[model samples]
Target: MSSNRRIGIIDIGSNSIRLVIYEINSLQAYRVIGEFKQSARLSQRINSDNTLSREDIQSIVAILKQFQRICTANQVEEIRAAATAAIRNAANSQQIISELQEYSGIRVELLSGEDEARIGFLGMIHSLDIPDGILIDIGGGSTEVSLFRQRKLVRSVSFPFGAVNTTRRFSADGDFSEEKLLSIRQMVREAIGGERWITEHPGLPMIGLGGTIRSLCKINQKKHKYSLPLTHNYPMSAEDMAELMSWLPSLPAEKRKKVDGLSKDRFDIIVPGLTILDTLFKESGCSHYVISGAGLRDGLFQEAYLTDNSAIGMSMPERSARNMLALHSCSPMAHLEQVASSALTLFDALQQTHGYDARARQCLHIAALLYRIGVSMTYYQFSKHSFYMIAHSRLDGLTHRETVLCAAIASYKAKSRVQQLYAQFKDVLLETDIDVIVKLGSLLQLAIAMDSSETQVLPVRSAAVTLDKELDITVQTQNDPSIEYKEIAALNKDFKKIWGLKLTLLDASSFSTN
Candidate 1:
């Protein structure tokens, strides 16, 4: 019944609904703790006019209450529920927010189109390592385009031509024609400052987001496989997507559902969605995309966490926070600070012997900080916690495969947890990475042992590594004789086992700052 540091976000988008719980890993990656999605289609009603019907309001209330129950049951400390186009443009948004907050404890913030676009990319830029590009997110009521140069978000524009809106304007009654399609393109061009706007940002990559792109990914995933349809990190080359674009406009509405790879759920509006994608691709002159299931919901949760006091909990142990986030929408920040410090200390002590370059050391640092995150469940049974949190956190700055290695090393917090963790990742996680995780775990264990006092654990501030036969560590100290040799005996033994060399420790009485 211990508490966690989970933060929950309820995203009321145009096409679907979602609630996500996430936490930071030892690698500073925010993984998804838990998530639930509902396809409410709130956008369908509000697109034609700036108003919400009684049914649309009621549908929103019911979903908000359900999400509230989830937040309460999980003991979520933070909740940031935001509405996009539908609610923002609604004639009666004030009344809606008042009703939701009163009944469900879910306060609603109506986001302007530009702010909506910026919030959606929070997870995309920080966790996934997206390069400079135009981030185009097509929603139910509007499309948001943000421009970035060398990774900084520079200029952003939003258009009223979202999926549901465009369908109403151009694909009424599920029919497609060259003229209707041209109008859709014309609307998009005007909203984004004409066709020449594309030439301004020459070669920046186009990082597509939102439901329209993900649905397209599902279709391409099926078409690429040919036999069985499966969804999970199915990367689509721009060339592959361009080939499929040619055929969609010509296909009739009812016949669209009959086509292979089209999901029954999206048959009606996929053409409009694809039209938006096609125009953007042609104009951007960029190919290659990183498809993600994470969008506004993830970004909203991240922004809420930073704004809330929950960020204070980020310094707790990974095990404690992982356990908390497991039960709630929370995790401890202790692991981030502790493991980060320990890894830096160990890296400084053994850089030469460990053969670590700057990037390799940084990787180890991330893995170390995120290691104990898996142990957050049952403290004694922490390896599983490491595996799930690291792999599934949906953190920014990491690929799905890169996350497996982060989880792998975290499993080593408990001996033999590696094999169990590796069972799922051997095909994806590299052998060298597995070795590094084990090495990092062992080194971390040594560092923790050295700081037996825990109080005023000065940490190995500076050290030199020598390899004659055994690894020799010459460490300097800044404090008086409060530290004891007995406190560090076990650390040397663990050092020997992991390195296959004896550990020799020399402590200097006093040191001068160079």
Candidate 2:
């Protein structure tokens, strides 16, 4: 399998068309290289007879042609294009696809409502660590709701109405009378009422996809001055969503655009979109709404390009951490793995003293694996670069607090430097986290020193806290480990200060004989 491959995914949605190019690395870890989107509003172009107009068909072809050219220029090896809702529901769907293929030289895969729901579920499952939830994606002309348990798709349904056509139907006069709101709410409730599975799963987190959900998350983030700028895994309570929906209708059409975090292009359709979300929230009695940045396009990319499922059993944080290592680290995998193993050994051995939980252990492990990722940029102050990269990259399955802590642990040069970094993200972190970071940071530093030679020869044979408030570690080494001893000696001051234990090193053979 090729280690580096570029694939392009073009999504023909009813409200917009988008093309995203991804660079997939050897480990099947991917990142977006280029993204382009244009709002065509194809749903509004459908005639009363359920067929798209010839002019609209030409418009679709034109957009695809441009996307094809962009893909060609990027040297994309494979291009996967799919159409949903608008083209799939149209009576002349086959004709539209034929013309698009003939003119654009890209075969369009018209995804069915069920297929869209399933693919969206695939994207969500791979990106998020949530074991069970309700997935909702609201496009321009259709809405897909799927229920999953244990990360497997259970039931999915697609509603024929979406933000675009719903707005056209009820708010055509540009007036949201109380009657119109009621009608819209009633219609949404009635549409989803038939799906008993949605109502049965009360209090499960509702994972949302599509533009409307993203916009909602942004608006909330801006409103509260959220500390983290990330949108994925952003959580909003049902009450918060209800509050936003309630306030949105009060604003005049022109005034709504002035609100922060809302895109100018989505101004007209946002209200209807929110209404659909609000309806889903109330109907399902969900505990909270989490935004999923990955959706159908990501799902398509994963299905077509990613073949490695070896990381399936790993936790989300570990899997994502490994991916980051694969993508960015210039160090040998064996060296990194050794460092991580030593860190974990020390963590487990010292459990009786620090008493940190598994979460802290996870952070320590991830930090150990990625501490050297910054070497790819520059060796000088690489820890700082590593801190910047790990803190910024979507380390995927980690919470905001965990991600920050991992960065702090990886970049640990001194207690002072870690403290300075913690000050910046205090909003997401607890004051006590400083202690966790320092302890784990020291452990990581010690772990790196054990493998400073990068030969994985000196392994921690055993570690234990003695009665005199001293940590004694035995290393298994055939040859003299004077360099490793020297590195470990340097950390004694900070380690004792943070852990309240004097550090002692013992050779495995010497300790057994004694």
lDDT by residue (132-227, candidate 1, tens digit) is 777788888778777777667787777767777678767667777888888877766665565355547756667777877777777676665432
Q: How many steric overlaps are in each model, in order?
A: 32, 0
Q: Which pairs of residues collide in model 2?
A: none
TM-score of model 2 relative to the true fold? Answer: 0.95
Per-model C-alpha lDDT, please?
0.65, 0.87
lDDT of 2 by residue, 172-264 (tens): 644466677888899888887798878998989999999999998999989988777888887888888988888887777788888899998
Worst 10 residues of 2 by lDDT: 505-514
Q: State the displacement of the C-alpha of residue 211, model 2, in Å, after optimal TM-score superposition.
A: 0.8
Task: Name model 2 segments beyond 4 Å from true.
Answer: 1-3, 173-175, 478-480, 509-514
Candidate 1: deviation at residue 375, Å?
3.4
Shift in Å, residue 359, candidate 2: 2.2
Give the top-scoring candidate (lDDT).
2
